[model samples]
Target: MDRIQEIVDFWFLPESDENYGKQREVWFKKNPDFDAEVRGKFLEDFEKAEAGELLHWSESARGSLALILLFDQFTRNMFRDSPRAFAADGKAREIARHMLSCGFYDELNTVEKQFAALPFEHSEDMDDQKLSVKLFEELGSGEALDYAQRHLEIIERFGRFPHRNEQLGRESTKEEEAFLKTPNSSF
Candidate 1:
């Protein structure tokens, strides 16, 4: 119990631009003593969010934190704490729809805001999908679609983002190292 509380406190500390992102990555990815139960709780809440279980984040700071965790994991390809029994069933679309309509996301940290687009990115709705294609077409003879496709393909190849290597203190592979050198490495 004490250990769990300590972890929670560590996570909830007031975030600042001063190495906050690096500190967070180290704590989350490097801490060997991290409590699994706390992580499990985070994952369970993420599952709840994906299942389209509505949460009133404005009414509860804890709930808002869980929302942040869900978005955080999505960016890293950790969609759920545990693997789902079935594939996504448009529940993410529903959750994304709700999040877009809510004001709660305005409260997230800066780096977290970078992943704020995950829900929209994974939205499988036909209309949304059509819009993405339409937008690409509207860019007419431009490189928008090509660039977007290449980036998406890279993500498909690497479950997690390769651009985050330096940020996360991870060693870059030769391919990633080469990719990182290109202007198209990251946006």
Candidate 2:
């Protein structure tokens, strides 16, 4: 299979309890091998996709999701702890919004929809955070909804994610510093 198909297949495995647990393990945990694999396999495609050269991928739901994964998820793994990790966030958010506007988002399963909604959830913008909460709620994703709500609450209080201060080079406020000490303050 092509790289895009490979990503789609790996990410959207058949829905089963064991598969879901494995998916969460990959999604939430840090694994150097998996990170290295994404870096080695998809880094070039990620660059091309970020440059807007892969517009054709938006022609279908699966393809669009793959593009989003490249922009949002893979970037984090490939460029961890650098500002470059967030460089493609705007493109990811754009693709996600396009997917929603084009009705492609409705074609996704719950797990897929959660990922498609993640760009918004990851945004610092309040409106985007609100939309993320709404989307998670609509999807009936209990854990995701809880996190989305927490993200929205943080955005409401701080205007931006304080956890990003160190990586983005923005100085955190004293209050933000205290909040950062709390567990789960940063997603």
Candidate 3:
């Protein structure tokens, strides 16, 4: 029910009036396979953000934002994929950066509760850790794997991964998997 989750939900839910699918068809052509609880939480967040309730962006947002921008740039240079999906808007990025600098994530959890109280159109896409890992890999820093593992462990520990994905899958490039299997490769 966080603000970011809300934004993510509003942008993807087929039934949502604010669905971003029409504007970004390729990003969301097929419906995501998320459960009702997850979808509800995301919608909860989206409603709060839309209501003008300020969210404290994560401390990791600057790093996250930078990586996404870099990945877009790298892909443009290397493979010429879709014209950069990262926001080029300096104002928005700056606002996000400032939020990251000013607030703690724990504080944001309270804000998320307020968001969850509101009703909103349902949405279903909550593979947040998977997306994080993908973003990390695209940045080519290998930190994505670390970030993914942290989230995956939480899901496993909480027994949520099975409900989320029968596979409870985590992305791994062939090279990365090989590296993990190799002995004494910790860096």
Candidate 4:
């Protein structure tokens, strides 16, 4: 398979296999450098898109940029062993920084906008959650309200995502899992 398809598969593999999440821990433990290798590949893809070399999988620059950011964030969370993984202190700021430079937020539709705000609200900043809530409210959709409520809850408490324990390779507590199930979790 082509490289892009491989990344795409990597992005969704866990959804396809219930064992995939646990299995990934095994693979990465054997090759701790793999995460950096994957990040390099993502940077290459982003650069290629900048040079107008992207093909087949997507046609829009915005979609491509969002996908890169999404997977970048996801991989960092999933593969905590990655040397380049985002740290807790400034993770949200890093994502928001990327989003600012993305230069294509306005091009997204309402639904896409909601999904695109993941990096912001899911950040370490409580204000990012407010921004996310406002953005979702602007969409005026029921799904958005659900998201707004969830973001509010996070902002009210941790000011960051807690259900991330599983992906961060820590066992999630019962309270954490209960919190995850109660609202709109990333899972």
Instruction: Estimate the TM-score of every prediction.
Output: 0.39, 0.93, 0.22, 0.47
Candidate 4 ranges beyond 4 A from true positions: 1-64, 67-103, 166-187
The lDDT per prediction is 0.45, 0.88, 0.32, 0.53
Where is model 2 more than 4 Å wrong at Cα?
Answer: 14-22
**Candidate 4 vs. true structure, TM-score:** 0.47
Among all windows of ten consecutive residues in candidate 1, which has the lowest summed lDDT? Answer: 77-86
Candidate 3 deviant stretches above 4 angstroms: 1-31, 54-95, 103-187
Q: Write the per-residue lDDT of candidate 4 for residues 78-187, one digit (tens) a residue.
A: 44543335442243344334544665456655544554565655555667767767767776777656767676786577555666665457666666677778745652
Residue pairs that clash (backbone atoms under 3 angstroms), model 1: none
Which residue pairs clash in candidate 4? none
Best-performing candidate as measured by lDDT? 2
| lDDT (Cα, tens digit) per residue for candidate 2, span 115-187 | 9999999999999999999999998868889999999999999999999899999999999999999999987
The superposed Cα distance between candidate 4 and the true structure at residue 129, in angstroms, equals 0.7
lDDT for 137 (candidate 4): 76
Which lDDT tens digits does candidate 1 get at residues 16-70? 4355533355423523335444455455555665655635542433354345445
